[model samples]
Target: MIDMDRKLGRWRLRVWGLVINLVANAIALFGIVAVVEGGSPALLIIGATLTVVCVAALAIPPRSDS
Candidate 1:
């Protein structure tokens, strides 16, 4: 029973992490588009850099065991 609970908790954490990453990625994409529409190369570059950082951060798994 305890093992099952632990597994469920891990699954929940993974799902939540995925959801957060997805939202962050979508926002970053939209930011890039907005920057392009506004005709600012600087903003576009910054947005793209931030998006890459955000996605990289999301891709990295936590160190501590659940």
Candidate 2:
């Protein structure tokens, strides 16, 4: 039973990490395009901030068993 829960928790973390990676990549691409098009610096800053958050999230491990 505990093993099953641990497996499920690991799966959840993997999925969340994938999502964060996707979002971070998309935001980075958009920021690059925006910069080329003379868009606001604020957008680029926000994208960078989000990327940092994603990286941090990926670095953190999931919670242990209750």
Q: In model 2, which runs have C-alpha deviations exceeding 4 angstroms?
A: 1-11, 61-66
Q: Model 1, stretches more than 4 Å misplaced?
A: 1-11, 39-66
Where's the lowest-lDDT run of ten residues in candidate 1? Answer: 1-10
lDDT of 1 at 44: 52
> What tens digits encode model 1's per-residue C-alpha lDDT throughout 1-66?
122112354474445545666665666677678776885556455556666655555565554553
lDDT of 1 at 36: 67
The Cα RMSD in angstroms, rounded to one decimal, for candidate 2 relative to the true structure is 5.6
> Which residue pairs in candidate 1 have backbone atoms (N, alpha carbon, C) closer than 3 angstroms, thus clashing?
none
TM-score result, candidate 1 = 0.45
Considering every candidate listed, which one attains the maximal lDDT? 2
